[model samples]
Target: MLSDLPIRKIIHVDMDAFYASVAQLDNPELKGKAIAVGGCETRGVISAASYEARKFGVKSAMSGNLAIKLCPELIFVKTNFERYKEISKRIRKIFLDYTDLVEPLSLDEAYLDVTKNKKGNPSASLIAQEIRERIFNEVGLTASAGISINKFIAKVASDYNKPNGQKTVNPEEVLSFLEHLDIRKFYGVGKVTAEKMYQKGIFTGLDLKSKSLDFLETHFGKSGRYYYHVVRGIHTSEVKPNRIRKSLAAERTFSENLSSEVFMLEKLNHIAEEVSKRLSKSKVAGKTITLKIKYSDFSLQTRSKTLPYYINDKDLIFKTAQDLLYQEQLNNSVRLLGISLSNLNTETKKTPEKESVSVQLKFGF
Candidate 1:
């Protein structure tokens, strides 16, 4: 029965603690130490943490203050994106040597379709092993590889044996492998979705497979259809190599919460200016303008407007954000504000007239 399905050899490769590992590799003194790359212990959010730091409850997007509290001796290093980008390029080049169908999830992770590779190797498992070896030898970094028939399974399997390891799920073993997998472990299933599934008496892939399409659709809406197929080992989403940026945005967190509309308007103006600069630099314009607000209590909301014509001007972006800000009721003190443009026109290649005035406001509060 499974022979009728189109089988593709997809591989997901993920670097192990990319930024922190790079720092550790460059500085031997940092090895075996809890390291965080982003900001100092006083402020800023952690962009990445070493496995040692992770063991101490330090994680990315967490405040530096909290990270220090969790791991008292945590070493802090500023981000070096230029170096990371260079390393990412090297890794992509290595992937291209094997297959052109590479989809990068981030600077550290990518999905490669290698059913028929340049080496004429039929075994996806062997190709993944060689890729990992090549990355280690050439880039001096460790990567974990997951091999399976499709992207979803490959992504999940990559984490099974992490930190310079690999796991392969053959076509015949897909269903059996997913049966015992926890519902929370499924791709795209978050904490809230897991809780909802738990409440609905679904706790594993086995349980999910028991639900009929109509029942799942009636309960979970559009996502139910997704769950229904994924549980039965039926994911067909191809690896998109040249994924376009859906939106470009700039946001800042204030040191102190502002209750006054005047203060929010000032912050919004700065954010809008930064967004406009990014759009102009990319030689792209968009019709949709989005204003994002985060309250002092951490509650967030977004308001957006789509215009008939595309724009990349700072004045127009700020004006649109200003209108959206005034239209909504300020229910709570504001802590963060962001502006974004989407539905882009990438054909325009206009050179920016001036340098961008970008700002990074890190507020401990």
Candidate 2:
């Protein structure tokens, strides 16, 4: 499959600790501090913790209260998704200038197919370097990039050098790199799956490649084909444009702490307007509305309501958030407000057969 596909240069650019890093960028004072962005309350969880917080054992999805206890000096900041998205758009513009083959994994990362280039740069590695430099120079932020013949290796290469660095894996070096890599680092190999593979003596990519396709298929069921292909670095992932508007979400961080219901509701209105504009721009409608609030204590809460029919109008989103706001009994002062619309029903044909296959969640959130 890979041989039939384009022999292109693929680059994976991933931002390190994206949310926390964005916070640091906006507020220079947060630099070098152990920072957490998410819910601050005992019941809330950390969305993104800086490396400093990670050093103190704080991590994403971990309970906020536990994170604070582990590192009492942890500084909590609410998420500002709107600002992040704006910055993401500017970065994406840079990618499109290089090539139209830009597939966004999220606001923080993307895969670029630059086999045929606009710049006519001799090497993909050099292109990646330029892209990283451009992001830093224009956005005042650092990004790590990976370069390789295929997507899988390129994704891995990006992580080889973390936090403002780049790595490349040429065709000759691929096998040796896989040989020394721990099984956990292999794409799609999670803890449970790695343990199972270990039990089967599949400890490395070389070992994994050695297994019979039938044996892998019989043991792993449908995922065997994927295992067989990935071990040999046969990645069929494509870099396609992400223009669909399945959902639009916006959030903001307060300059100061806030606990008032009136103040928080007002912030929700602004975010609702942003979401509404995005939905209108995409010419889409949504069936579900969600409200996200983060308190000064770092507690986060979300309330969602699905309508009987689809709607994308701003007033409707605002009203939905207002209802969810009233439900919050003022347990904490909200430091951030977010509005999201989901269950989008765009004006398009039924999902194409090719697109119907559920892509594995090995990467891209």
> Over 4 Å off in model 2, which ranges?
1-5, 243-282, 285-365
lDDT scores of the candidates, listed in order: 0.86, 0.80
lDDT of 1 at 202: 94
Over 1-365, each residue of candidate 1 has an lDDT whose tens digit, in order, gives 34545677889999999999999988899999999998668766689999999999999988788899999999999789789989999999999999878889999999998876798887788888999999999989999999987789999999999899999988778899999999988998998989999999999999999999999999899999999988888887777776666788998877677899898888888888889888988878999999998886678899999999999999999999999998869879887788989888753434333222221221110
TM-score of each: 0.88, 0.71
Residue 257 Cα positional deviation in candidate 1, in Å, after optimal superposition: 3.7
- Mark the regions of model 1 whose C-alpha exceeds 4 Å error after superposition: 259-263, 346-365
Instruction: Give the candidate number with the greatest TM-score.
Output: 1
RMSD (CA, angstroms), candidate 2: 7.4
- Look at candidate 1 and tell me the lDDT of residue 62: 84
